[model samples]
Target: MRLVPIQSVKEGSILAKTIYDSEGRVLLKEGTELKDITISKIEYLNIYTIYINDKYSDAVIEDVIKPEIRQKAIKKVRDVFYNLEDYNKNQNNYQGQNLYKKSEKDFQSVQYVARELIEEILSRKNVMIGLVDLKSFDDYTYQHSVNVAVIALIIGMKMNFHKYELFDLCIGALLHDIGKVFLPNEILNKPGELTEEERKIVQEHPKNGYDYLKGSYDVSVPARIVALQHHERIGGQGYPEGREGERISILAKIVAVADVYDAMTSTRVYRKALSPNEALEYIMANGGTKFDYKVVQAFSKVVIPYPQGTMIRLSNGDIAVVTKVYSQMPLRPDVKIVYSEIGTEINSIMELAKENSIVINGLEYEVPEDN
Candidate 1:
């Protein structure tokens, strides 16, 4: 079976998957055959339509339904953070071994954790407040660190970084914020503005994190350097030593771009969270001064500004939700929107191609209630 846009979907096509409502109501079950009115009415709904034959099965669902496993990995990382005291006693604090092993052992698990983290951060406006209820700040930190590592890894993957180097990059990115453990909770969670002294203290986290990892674990120099120099800027205005330009390691530069992008898109005490596109714009604007230009471009290619499952408003008096992203045109992907022009929910999906259709002039980060 082939996934086709609703516009070209012919009648007699079989339903490939079960259609569910926002309230979890099963609107249509698998094996349901399409009628002409059903297709036309659902076409107005601007939803995704899959053309299926007898051979199509639920194999796709199995691949997409692994959030439970991802959550398990997240819980394990959280445990490490929660039991940092034990970890430290066992000589495991800030050591890069944990980060490296987790990534090497389970790259998919790491990627899923990162994807969930990104969705949560983007959805919630207050980062610290949103994270506070997650039981352990340490786990939150670890999960976030892992998230950043995966982000860097994704960036590196796009740049064709070697597998070993990619693994090292993931390890370094995972441990990039480890020094925050030594920081005072008051300073870290301060809702108000931070003083220069407090800012300086915060800036020391990279160096401190690097020290903790280097001394505790037997990680490579690139991994250690990434933790230390991830904050160093291209214009020699970053933290610790402010080493300029090529003096910084490539891994450090890559992590820096991912780190700042995640931080900006994440909620902070002093400001509201920026949307993904907004944060990317900020990174691009300051590319040469605050970030590496090539890294920023790579990041832009890897991360979709409007990720899947996000709701968007169309010009045709309808609300559409992104269901999938197309590699060729990342911005214009497949969307599934609810419709009831005939007083019945014409549940289906739509593909927004740049070829010929109502142009999607606006985009949103929030998922719709009826998705």
Candidate 2:
């Protein structure tokens, strides 16, 4: 199965994986053949790309975390956020004992899910994290949390972190933005630029999340630090705390890189999502200033700059689909030539690292449906 942009998807193509809506409802089941109406519906839902079975491309992109595990993790995050929101709405209504019990349960659930996520990522270190941004505007917070956890765990694995360290890192990454649950909906989802005061209010999330976790008994110190310091930069420019250099915890440093990357790549009310390659470049460029250089290097090693099944234009003007990614050379991957510059068919696979004269010039947003 190969991943393809929705614009290039044609009728009769088999769906390789089930598509789910923001509410966890399955919209298209696996093996369902795409018809015009189905395609239109997917497009209407704002889905940009999907997995489809194609004989021409044998490339397979696997999810680092299983679908069931991911769904459960998302649901767990949603539940915790919902509980927090509910508690804020009626803090006086619930007894202290009852509230404490609920909070404990939620923290336990997060730890269990975090361990599972770490194991899943460690089990498949070679598989590039290629999660599609299928989140709806309403569920953005929950989905974004899960995405950060997965990305952080991947980077941590590449750094050879121990199992316990990985667990703390994953938990911290998952709840790094949990404080946003307390922000007003209008300010959190505002489509326009924020005022100076509003920006300061938004920046208080790290402290707010840290305070929330500090009261919990199950959270580790590393995890709490992540919630507090994920936004702290190496050059003392970050918010909540302008911590620089060794002042920032290693766990928070890893989470910070993951948080920034996921935030940039996710679509928001204010801006369009950056492509994965563009997001990575932004992170790399900011390394040692906005992010820890070592953590950024580990992230670059694990993530695929140009993921498989993505179409690209070579410097030679050949349009091809990425067939495979090499760990050593992420910028250049194997590509299967589907069309020449003149738009003629040419079925040939080229290992980009072996071809010194060719380089990917640009990514093709749309490809011929007939191919």
Candidate 3:
């Protein structure tokens, strides 16, 4: 299977993986053949890319969290947020108590999903995480929460965090942005520059999330701290509280790295998403100030800088598709040469770490047609 942009998807292409809607409903099932109307419907849903079966590029990118688990987790998180929204709308109603109970149940379900994700990651210590963000703008928050949880868990495992500790960290990561649920939809989704008052409200999400999580009888102190302190920077430049260095809880610090990484790599209302390599570079550059250095170090170990299925140009003028990523050498992954400078098919795989003379120049969206 090969990952292709929506524009490149043609009629009769087979979907290699199931695509889910905002509510976790399957929009298209695996092995479904694409028709003209189906492709248009996919574009209308704002999906940017998809995995399709193809003979030339059959390399499979493995996801640490399985699709079914991820979809269920997204639904659980969405339910919790929707419940919170409903409660906010009827703050004076007696149904508030029952809604809170339902929210708590949803939280428990999310935690269970988190544990499963941690187990999957732990089982495969050698696989570099190849999570691609295929979410639309409307589904960003739900997908992002799950992605952050997965990223944080991988980093936590690399740090040798115990299972219980990993559980708290993952829970915290999943709900770190819960405060945003309280913000007005206009303010949260506004595409233009925010006024100072709007900016302050946006920054208050950490404290708001912290307060919300603190009321839960089952949440741990460390998990609550993650909601409160994930935005606190090491250099005391962060928001809600300008906490610095060790003042931030270790769990919060770890989540901070995951939060920023996912946010940077995801397309928001105001900006385009950064490439995985670009996002990692940004994280590395701000390691000591904006993020905890050790956490960033751990993050570098698990994230695939150049994800598989991306077409890239080599410094030597060859065009290749990434086949696999080596955790130890992220910048130099295994690639299959799909075309040469003369626009001829080469069909050879190269382990870039061993190819000392080669360097990746930049990414290419599509290979140039053979001349």
Candidate number achieving the greatest TM-score relative to the actual structure: 3
lDDT of 3 by residue, 124-241 (tens): 8565556465777888888899888888888888888999999999889888899998899999999899999999999999999989888887678898899899989999999888
Give candidate 1 regions above 4 Å deviation.
1-139, 268-271, 314-318, 334-371
For candidate 3, the 10 contiguous residues with the lowest summed lDDT are: 94-103
The models' CA-based lDDT, in order, is 0.60, 0.82, 0.82
> Can you give the TM-score per candidate against the true fold?
0.60, 0.91, 0.92
Off by over 4 Å in 2: 1-12, 22-25, 43-48, 54-56, 95-98, 125-127, 131-133, 342-345, 368-371
Query: Per-residue alpha-carbon lDDT of model 1 for 1-371, expressed as tens digits?
Result: 33344555556877765544322345566688988897776545433343343221122221111334334545545443444434555554557657434334243443344445444433433111101111112234554565566567667766768767876786677667767766777998887999999999999888877876665434567888998999899899998999888989889999898777767655444564455566667888988887888887777776665555444556664666566776556667777665324324344566778535654544433323443
Cα deviation of 306 in candidate 1 (Å)?
1.7
- Which wins on lDDT, candidate 1 or candidate 3? 3
Give the better candidate number (1 or 2) by lDDT: 2
Clash pairs, model 2 backbone: none
Rank by TM-score, descending? 3, 2, 1
The positional error of residue 243 in candidate 1, measured at the CA in angstroms, is: 2.2
True-structure RMSD, every candidate: 12.5, 2.4, 2.2
lDDT of 1 at 334: 75
- The per-prediction tally of clashing pairs is 6, 0, 0
lDDT string, candidate 2, 1-371, tens digits: 66566787888999988888665778889989999899998878767667888665556667778888888898888888899889989888875646656788898999999988887877774756564545656678888899889888888888888999999998888888888877898899899999999999999999999998888878898999999999899999997979999999999999888887878777677887777778888999998888899998999888776778777878997788888888778888988888775544477789989999888886665556554
lDDT of 1 at 24: 34
